[model samples]
Target chain A: MKMHNFNSGPSILPQEVLNQAAEAVLNFNNIGLSLLEIGHRTSWFQDVLDESRSLIKELMQLGEEHEALYLHGGATTQFMQVPMNLLDDGETAAYCDNGIWGSKAIKEAKLFGNVNVVASSKDKNHTYINKGFEIPATSKYLHYTTNNTVEGTQWHALPETNVPLVADMSSDIFSRNMPFAKHSLIYAGAQKNMGAAGVTLVVVKKDVLGKIKRAIPPIMDYRIHIENGSLLNTPPVFAVYVSLLTLRWIKKEGGLAEMEKRAKERAEYLYNALDSLPLFVPTVNKEDRSFMNAVFVMQRPELEQPFLDECKKNGMVGVKGHRSVGGLRVSMYNAMPMDSVKAFVELMTEFNNKNL
Target chain B: MKMHNFNSGPSILPQEVLNQAAEAVLNFNNIGLSLLEIGHRTSWFQDVLDESRSLIKELMQLGEEHEALYLHGGATTQFMQVPMNLLDDGETAAYCDNGIWGSKAIKEAKLFGNVNVVASSKDKNHTYINKGFEIPATSKYLHYTTNNTVEGTQWHALPETNVPLVADMSSDIFSRNMPFAKHSLIYAGAQKNMGAAGVTLVVVKKDVLGKIKRAIPPIMDYRIHIENGSLLNTPPVFAVYVSLLTLRWIKKEGGLAEMEKRAKERAEYLYNALDSLPLFVPTVNKEDRSFMNAVFVMQRPELEQPFLDECKKNGMVGVKGHRSVGGLRVSMYNAMPMDSVKAFVELMTEFNNKNL
Candidate 1:
């Protein structure tokens, strides 16, 4: 049976990417060495490093002004590293806490400096983005998550802020093209829309680094990684290789514009199915619904199991929502095909008819 | 041509392990979904986590007294984390700086507490371990790297310390059995002998945590990860899975005792080949020669290129030594077959005859 993957992260990747990644792991760049075992310093691996970084720059359409670094420790590590590198000890950074990831970032940032919660959707259980709050002029930077994977809310537009913007696009990166110049720094863990789970991609304005006064640990220092070309130590080689493959796939599939169109079509189909059905209710506010993840609850609680079972029988996987949200979440990442979404929607309609 | 991989880390893995890992990435544990796209909270992933952790405990022969935690940020992060969790700001920790990794650990340790260098092999350009050194009885813990990957040295026996001992066994972990009980903490980056590059394996005595005066970051706090079952954040899921496969392979091929015997045999074969040849000279002290990585250099500089080319033609890869030590290093890690070692030895003999 053909499986439609809908897990939040370590999510779906294009088949071409997977095949290329597998081939490289078997024999990298025709080097007769597994990508897993090649020395990070070798020209073969360096090509991977350079190409992966270049692809991100190309995808974002960022020029020499932005530097892309493939760093370890995932997005969670960046939560602390961002403030440690950008904010002085007593300075303040603005954070828009739209969901769990945003709140976590704020928490880590507070370890290094004072965090001004410019806006928070926590009062409304993070079901929508709060747009009315003011950004402080004194803030060093403003941090926000582009998409909340758990809650299924996405920022369709950039937040208006005079301060330098830092976006954690972990769940929605590459799903669409955005105004890259609005953000001074953007980071994303590759598992969601990129490739694997271990590596975090960061695009920082080269001028913004080395401003903080703290003696940041070498691993936590962006300057160190960038200077060494992200090969200061042995990198997550396999993850980076897979990410490169995914990037190539994205380019072959007509880049982010086409990706956004396909993503929207998939998400709209699923959302429309939920809206028209009597047995399900969409969780997020209509205006704030995520194209990356569609969250919905069963109208009748008892029908939840049968609906999930029917989806599974139809070869849909990872439809179960995050434990915090307790419903169904269809993570339609960039690599998730329109056919998979149509299949899922068909299953949902069938289950709704039976249950209703 | 079959390539013999001798890269110190991101080293070679068993062919079967690679095949199995690739299969899992496509469809994990018979689930029709790609392992990459599976939800970690699902029973399927949880089972992988539990079994992987369990295998580590079993392979190490670690009893109920010890706890294992799989973490991110590699062993480098543990350098700071060890002191942050165990020593107060003003307290001192004893460190044995035998090579690069040990000195790095000492450097990171100084960030959290005062470090007393009990012994250092640096006086001899890190070519030999200092047999004579006194551990400070007043120090919080004694730290050392069990194997120096760069210098190609290994501790034949651990130093007897009154204080708690910590070992950075990144390069030699799981290659052989050692005194697990002798140390309060043992941390290893998983790339070398264990699995991939992103995950770090930490085995800490249960009683050693939560004594520091400083507020450690949640991710940096060893106790927090331990208490949370290393699920403090989403882990390097695929890396852990690969480690589990390697562990299973080790168990199936007879335990660590057999592994030690095989490693010794392989190292001896390669070392004998280098020693007997007039063209090559071993780099490390004979008594301290590493069983995992055998470092050597050409007796005459001009013979280096031809010898390296001949070895490359024989399908040996990554035998070129580290830049710090300009020579050749044949890292005979656990997965290296004795036949490959013999093949390398043959190449060495042919090159030696030509050079002489």
Candidate 2:
């Protein structure tokens, strides 16, 4: 069966990326050693690390002022480490409570210092990104999630903030055009559009560290990693290698500019079909709906399983919504082909005609 | 040219394991979706997670008291987190300073509480594990490194301590018989015998958590991971899958006993060659030499480059020692064949004769 992957994360990778990664697994760059077997310090593997860092900077148009680091301990770990490194004991960090990931970040930041939630969407079920939040003068940074993976909401524009902006772009990183230099730091877990699930990509301005009073744990501190070129200790070699390959694919496909164009096209196509189908209702607030993830619900609650089964019969995977919000979610990340989204829309339409 | 891999970590993988992982990268278990494309929550990937956790327990002969966790953030992260959960404010932790890794752990543990250096080998250049030091009665846990990659040292026996024994078994895990239940916790970075680099395997007793007065960051807290079955957040799917394959390979090759036998044979063959060679001098103390990593120096410093260049021409890789320790170190993990060791031994002999 030709299964069309709609998985949220650990999600779809391009066929060419898969082919290249598979080849590397057998024997990376014909070095007579599997990528799985090479040490991170080896010259060939160091080339991988170098290329990955270079590509991220090049794609984002980041200048020398910005330093990018590939690290272990996924984005969740970043939630605390970001605060642990940036926010001093007495200082506060402002945050926006938009969805699950943002809330988790807020929880972790509280452990380090005071967290001021300037805006929140939790009351009305997180259908929109809260806007026009005030950043406190005493705050060291303002943090937010660029896209809510579970709630299907994305910040289409960067929120204006004075104190250095930190965004968790885990699901939406490199998918669309990003105002790279505007933010102080961006951290993303590379499972969605990036690559496999082991590493996180962090881009930071080098000068921002060392201002804090408390001592940062060496492993968790951003200064040590940046100074050592992200090889302060052993990193996730295979994950980062796969991510580098994905970055190459992105560049070959015309970088994030083209990615944004294709993403917008996919979203419009599915959302139009959803708007026309009376049996299905898109769950997210349309204006704030995520281009990366399109969450929708059946008109009749009893028909959710049948619709899922019908889609399953046609080789659709991961159309099921998050358990917190019942329905279907089509995650159209950067690597997802237009044909897959077209097929999913057709499935939604055809299933509604038969069962509605 | 076919290279003989001897890198310390992210080192050699079993050929079958490589093939299996490569095939899955393209199409996992004939699921049509690439392993790189599948969601971690999917049944097949879930099966990979379950089997990996089970095998670690089954191999270690751990029963109801032991709970194995496959987590992100390598052993370095665990260096702080282990103490974060176990040690409290005003409490002290006893540490044995064997080598670089242990000292790194000591540095991280100090952030949490007072650390009493129970023993240290720094006086003798970390060539052997010091003994007969008293572990403090007020210490929360006694921490040590089971294998020192840089120093080429191993603790042949677990030290006698009244409190729980915590070990960083990053290099020598599953290669020899372990005192599984004797320790309260054991952690190893997966770049070694376990699999490729990404996840860290943590085996903890379920009831030992919540002993600390200071609050732990939820992501760093082992109790939450245990409660959620190690999937509190998205894990390193591909890394864990490869690790499961390695675990299966270990079982297919007759479990830990056979691993111990092969490890011993390889160590004896290399150590014997090192002892007999007049041109080479073993760097580690005879009583506590590592079976996994063999470190030795050329009898004359002037001949180091000539020997290294000669070995490079003859398909030897990673023969250079860590920069801090000036010599050659050959790391032969579980999947390293006795044949490769024999080939390297021959190379050492030929180089010695040619130069002399």
TM-score of each: 0.98, 0.98
Model 1 lDDT per residue over B1-356, tens place:
88988887788998888888778777678877666777666778788788888988888888877888998878887877788789898899999999989988889888777999999999887888778688878999999988999999999988887799899999999889888877899999888889878889999998888776777777788778878887877777788888888889999999799899999999888888888898889989999999998988898988888888887888888888888777888888889999999888888887778768
Candidate 2 lDDT (Cα, whole model)? 0.90
Estimate the TM-score for candidate 2: 0.98
Off by over 4 Å in 2: none
Which CAPRI tier for candidate 1?
medium
Q: Candidate 2, after superposition: displacement of residue A11 in Å? A: 0.7
Query: DockQ of candidates 1 onward, in order?
Result: 0.65, 0.82
DockQ of candidate 2 relative to the true structure: 0.82
- The sequence of per-residue lDDT tens digits that candidate 2 reaches over residues B79-192 is 888988998878899999988889999999999889999999999999887877888777888999999999999999889878898999989998988888888999999998
Give candidate 2's root-mean-square deviation (CA, Å).
Answer: 1.2
The deviation in Å at residue A202 for candidate 2 is 0.7
Query: What is the iRMSD of the candidate numbered 1?
Result: 1.4
lDDT, candidates in the order shown: 0.85, 0.90
